[model samples]
Target: MPHFHFHSVRLVKALLACAMLLASYAGAAEKLANVTILATGGTIAGSGASSTTTVGYTAATVGVERLIAAVPELAKVAQVKGEQVFQIASENMSDAYWLTLAKRVNVLLAQPDVDGIVITHGTDTLEETAYFLNLTVKSKKPVVLVGAMRPGTALSADGPINLYNAVLLAASQDAVGKGVLVAMNDQIHGARDVSKTNTSTPDSFKTPELGMLGYIQGNKPYFYHVSTRKHTADTEFDVSKIDTLPQVDIVYGYANVNPVALNALVAAGAKGIIHAGVGDGSLAAKVTPSLTAARKQGVLIVRASRVGQGIVARNGEANDDELDFVAADTLNPQKARILLMLALTRTSDSKQIQRMFYSY
Candidate 1:
């Protein structure tokens, strides 16, 4: 009887071991790639009085450690960890901040242990940072930038899901070489072309000229195309040596536009000025004097359209050739501002800046 009991015990152990092996195989198939989360304080880390307010929340409510604990399920997707770099509002970010952020990303991306990186930033300036990363970091592995318009404590906080999807994409092999991406409101947008169109809506981000690159479903990401922006390891644009970016101001065009602001910026040591022209990027009559005077002062001039879409061309309108301003092709005013600052870092020649506008 004792021998019979021992044999039965051996059979039970064998059956249990086989079941465990099968379960492990199935679990490994759906498992995600390794990804890292670098948290810079933003709405994603914010909290409200209750689960009712979103935009009205304060950003200092949660730290990186708590954020990780708040979402324990993240461990199931990746070997996730968070580091608190900064806890400031995104609108207050500066060129120096951009430099620091870029350097950090570069270091993490170079690490063999880190397969991917996710930056948690504020929605106010998330696109700009994304574009900056899109320009600077050179990694074949996926780098995703995500933000929340609503705080995590809000009734419909969008941070958790956005972070999840962004991290998912970051770890996915398919997302490699796709450049930097911004995942928000279930949509995946390319970094260079994406913009925040609405302040209150959950589905606020949009690529003016380009559609979404992909979408998230049930925590899984699907990609349709790759980002073709000239960036990291591909381009010569560097952010480290940029101590003081050239001052570039925007002059908006109205029915009766004035150049007083333009001329003042020039007088105040503005290195560059972007004139937000009227229809099809036509300079306002009042702005012509200031723009011409700016030209005489050796200040770099850029012409961008007030309208959100399309390209800008110089010498298109009558009396435009005499102005001699760089035309912002397909680049919006703010983007043109960034390019102008970057271009001025290397050369102050109008021809060279114009060439950059065309090429970049």
Candidate 2:
């Protein structure tokens, strides 16, 4: 009877150990982050006739499902799910699409199960979209925008690796509240400062003045800096109820510049104008009258430099107060347009808009 009782006790102990092992495995699986890839077609989804063809290829040819399938390694980092938000090259990305994407991101981030988001975009206008989302998204959840310079069908296509690194960034806890990020070539840049510096190349995206925020190594995200500007939930711009963005146009400033372009933009019902000036956002003496006249006609004018880097200081080079114009500060013309669009939704006051430029 004693021998039989001892064996029964040992059997019970073995069963308990087996149950604990299964529970441990289940816990580890549940700890994986739930990451969603919002694919808006770009060169990342592009294809070509030959693997060597990088240019003149058809973009947005692949879908999100195929993109995810190509990178099975993504499954190791997070529970990734793909959703096709739009199937157009990012150059064709419109204000309506921006609204749609922002709304969708907000909705997805609200879900308790979704930990972060990765957006696949075209390099052409990825910075614009990323900056737009930085100012408007209402959640602190990490939003990482990624794009490839070479088509996915290229011999050494960079899309898969970029996509994988982006997912890793989104799944990172350190990415939270860091505003929107642009991850490419294993480097992470703040959306507010990053720009497409090269026409075509895998290392095109750069933040000239502020530098990169972080980088990804071995599928792990290492952050070095945090953006000081307001963003995400801390930003005042909200796109939840916004239906349409205001009409803002960009005018290039060059030698022998004429007022016809500026006048034409105003004639075409442009609510705001961004003068991409030659140096320090300076307006040529020849074009100042037109800009002054436009501002007098209730049109908002902002001065941004064509020189890529440096700030267009208020009251520094131009008499922004006297002309009733706003300087673009450190923001490029493209990003300035995005801020002006959202600022117009709140108020058309130049003071308020200038304040918005400084803060955002």
Taking every candidate in turn, the Cα RMSD to the unseen true structure, in Å, is 4.0, 2.0
Task: Return model 2's CA RMSD, one decimal.
Answer: 2.0
Tell me the whole-model lDDT of each prediction, alpha carbons only.
0.80, 0.94
- The TM-scores, one per candidate, come to 0.88, 0.95
Best by the TM-score measure: 2
**For model 2, how does the per-residue alpha-carbon lDDT over 1-360 read when each residue is reduced to its tens digit?**
999999999999999999999999888788889999999999999999899999999999999999999999998889999999999998898999999999999999999999999999999999999999999888999999999999988999999999999999999898999999999999999999999999888899999788999889977889899888999999887888889988999999999999999999999999999999999999999999999999999999999999999989888778888999999999999999999989999999999999999999
Off by over 4 Å in 1: 1-32, 318-322
Deviation of model 1 at 33, angstroms? 3.6
Candidate 2 regions exceeding 4 Å error are 1-22
Over all chains combined, what TM-score does candidate 2 have? 0.95
The candidate 2 region of ten consecutive residues with least summed lDDT is: 235-244
